[model samples]
Target: MKRTVLLLVLLMAAGTASAQVPSPSQPPTPPPMPTPRGEVLYSCPGGIDFASTFSNDGELATLRMPGQPDIELSRAPSGSGFAYSDSYYELRGRGREATLTAAGRSMRCHAAGRPGEPPRTYAGGTLTVTLFPDGTFRLRDRREGAAEPVLDVGQWAQEVEGGVRMVLRGIDNSRRAFRELSVDKLVADDGTELRRTEKTDPIDGKFRLAGMYRDAQDGGLFTACLVGRTYGVAPGGAEPELEKAWVEATPSREASLYVEIIGGFDNNNSITVDRFLTLKRDGACPALVFRGSALRDTEWRLVELDGTRPTFTEWRRRPLMRLDDAGRFTASTGCNTLAGDFVLDPDGLRFVPGPMTLMACPPTEAEIEKSFVEALTAVRTAQISGTTLDLIDATGKRRMRLEARGR
Candidate 1:
């Protein structure tokens, strides 16, 4: 009886479990898949193409293309595609085309070809073009079959006067030719005639110079001069001659005076006055200043006892270096560079020589350097009264005085 009861209980439990379980063939149906969003297709005629899909949150989830490997650009919210082509291309909801042209080449973009659908074409030729979003565009051409250069229209010369007395010369490959084309005659505000003698030649035809003229009514006289085969126009017959004279007569002012030391000093280091020299304006022949140097107690004095003569051995012929209103001075001191500044004072003039790099020179050159430094250093004040410059030291001693040549 106990065994029978246990078997009965087990059978009842198995029957209840089997009744509650559902069959595998009758499972529940799944939810429908979400529709794709965002840009489905973007492409250009020159093989650039792209496609994209978005997630439920409107975020880009996938991007696909042909030829190029697929890329997952969804790190951030992504919904755009990029492609590279010879020319620019873009596609939105509807199909559109953009074309560009330059030189002898043309590029076109069109709707991508599909089964049973004709592909749209955007063709560009020698003309250059720019397309905008509002369906408007700009076109330009240089040569007849090429795109025009991106030059400012203001830079182009245009015909002003009616076809009268104007000449047109065309240039092609650096060769000049005459043409019967319209020429722009530029004129100044004062009614002065301005001529543009340069032009480019037409591609398909031989060029010729065009000449046009108008009646003169109080017009400026125009004279033409022919030298060999070249002709030039001037305002008057004597204009060219006057221009030449003015160019030749322009005065060139000298900036500084160059003084060179010549002759040898005596064994006692006494330099005689007769050996000194001065450079003239001719810049070729040096004038010998007979009394050039005088011997003072220990140092050779640049001035003689008579005080009117400068003593030196010899000086190279050079033009006097000129100075402007400013007191800054620059000059070549025979064998080396010399520069300094000068200040005018009531008593005398002061000269401050900038430091100079020393170089090896002959014995006479060394003496000249020493003397030049001493003369410059001893100046307490300097005055450019008239054409003469008088330098006086602090001890009331007259160091040197220079007179302007030809003054």
Candidate 2:
């Protein structure tokens, strides 16, 4: 009887505990997966490339490619395609094959390469070979103009797109005598045989010079473009010294090229060609950046010297200096007129004032003019920023400050 009573009490207690417990709740649903989106680089098997971000579903936006501006693209009215003006792009075969003509030329392209794909990253992939009629060729970074060629030389080719030559005369006077680089023997100073592009763009019909470049050893770069068949090179930081230099390019790829050079140099005038490549292309050409002389045609009036304001007793005049492209300087001190011969270069400025007028003047004014001429001779360098120019020495110490007139 006691055992039966205990069992009944335990069952009652279990039932009460079960009733007090709360029921379990269902798990929250996970957020829907983000729409698949990625960057797509559309290319003409061998011609040009266009980049865009796409929503795998259908839409593509931000088409950035060379030879054209950034074009915004949307899904086509019918199937999997996009359009901009007369340029219609039909991306099929999962982006492996497509047709687009925004580059002003219709092209049927394939996935040449992607941004992160090791084979198609910057400075990688199929080497672009540009040949010249003179049996010369350049290894370009890309297909179009504006890319500075990595290497340019007159070549004796063992093989090319089906042609052979010992020496070339692409231009009437284009070849350099006694210099022939075997197509196979071309290499960097450290000697690395460059590889060619693994695949060619289907639209890669011709190559042009358009791009920016710099030598790994140099401090800056230059922008090269062929503006209207006129090849040009514009420097970035310090101006370059160009002598007996001109570039020549052709309308046909591997047919003719603008053969010129953009490389690294130092104070001693030695060239080290390294890290030279091109990318920014314009209309298949280059623009020349030839800064003949900085001081030429520049006119200035002294504002302050050695931190003292101009002070003259009776007859006073503000010192004026004008330099012409021919390396001649004409100046007038507050009291006297002076002429001089001078040289201005990356080195330093040296003014050798020649004969001066001996016109008499007030004692204070004469003293001012004498010291003014002396200051001009001390200019070793110049710090020109817009309208203000500070003449500095080798130590970068400011000696005279002048203001540009009528800039």
Candidate 3:
């Protein structure tokens, strides 16, 4: 009975102990955990950005930020350091060492180099950061000496598309102020932007002033004018000039009755035979006077030849009649010479003559000689109307119609 009572008491005590202790098979409920503070949402080839509500320890803190400029940090002899975010910025330096923690990592950096230490510099340094449950992060720089911020933190942003627009204002060395431009657009493999097309402005304009027309048969000077000005005359002559003299044909004249002067200075000076001569069948040829620098005071007679042939034979040995592809005519007047090109048209013929050589001849002969040459070189075209030959010069300056010399 004593042993039973003892065993029961022990059992009751064990049961009470067992009731006090939790069952080993059952797991205890855990307390609620705090949310992580900081995170690295995005990064690019040049930069990265981390956001956290961390306390700023007395030491300088550096962080990589997107779209931000690079940062730099340096140490001074006063056991102090300077940090900059962009080009040349100076930051406050404290003697305390700095630590940074972000993205589940941490780094520590000292203010200055140690004794007997080789000089060391860092372009980019490893970064470590720790995030507390309270949305706070501890950032550390794991370099021997102070370092610059990975980039300018001022321009950091989470979602930057179409990018931030930056306006740079400054004066040039010449004191000329201008605005700088920055454009952001997608580019193709050829380096051309997808948005830009075709040039906006024009390239050039038209050609002007082709040439002047001169009648080959008559000494008519004609020029196509675009500027409302006459050409082929004495430069200072009448502003608005008329077309050069022209020629027409009359009945009973041969179509090749024009004269043209050749072999002169630019054909400026030449002689011409008037086409108005009437052809007479008499054995004696009609006489015409050619007065110019090349001509002497003499009369030349035209001899009627048999078989419709025209020839010149006298003191001066030369051809009396010359025929060109256009039926315009040229002949030696026994002096300065005569030549012309002519144009034959339905209405009439245009004649252009060359200028006469300024050689001084007898006054009476001078006028005739110059006039004859001027009449010839200007001939533009020739035609036959009835028995008459009409000659027109290139410029339509001069015109002549000749009747049949021999009836």
Name the weakest run of 10 consecutive residues (lDDT summed) in model 3. 288-297
Q: What's each prediction's TM-score?
A: 0.23, 0.31, 0.17
1 or 2, greater by lDDT: 2
lDDT of each: 0.29, 0.40, 0.25
Q: Write the per-residue lDDT of candidate 2 for residues 42-129, one digit (tens) a residue.
A: 3333334344556556466555442233345665553332332323433332223344542233444333222222221012233434
**Prediction 3 global C-alpha lDDT:** 0.25
lDDT of 1 by residue, 1-407 (tens): 32233234223323201122333332122122123343333222232223444444543334333212223333232122222222221211211222222222322222111211211111123323222121112223345644534211000001111111211111221211122122233333234443332332112211121111111223211110000000121233333343333234323321111211122112331211222133222221121111111000001112221144534455431212222225554433444445556554233345676645344545655555666667677867543322244556676666565533210
Candidate 1, poorest ten consecutive residues by summed lDDT: 222-231
Cα RMSD of predicted structure 2: 32.2
Candidate 1: where are CA atoms >4 Å away?
1-314, 317-323, 345-348, 383-387
User: What lDDT score is found at residue 308 in candidate 1?
Assistant: 45
Worst 10 residues of 2 by lDDT: 156-165
Which is superior by TM-score, 1 or 2? 2
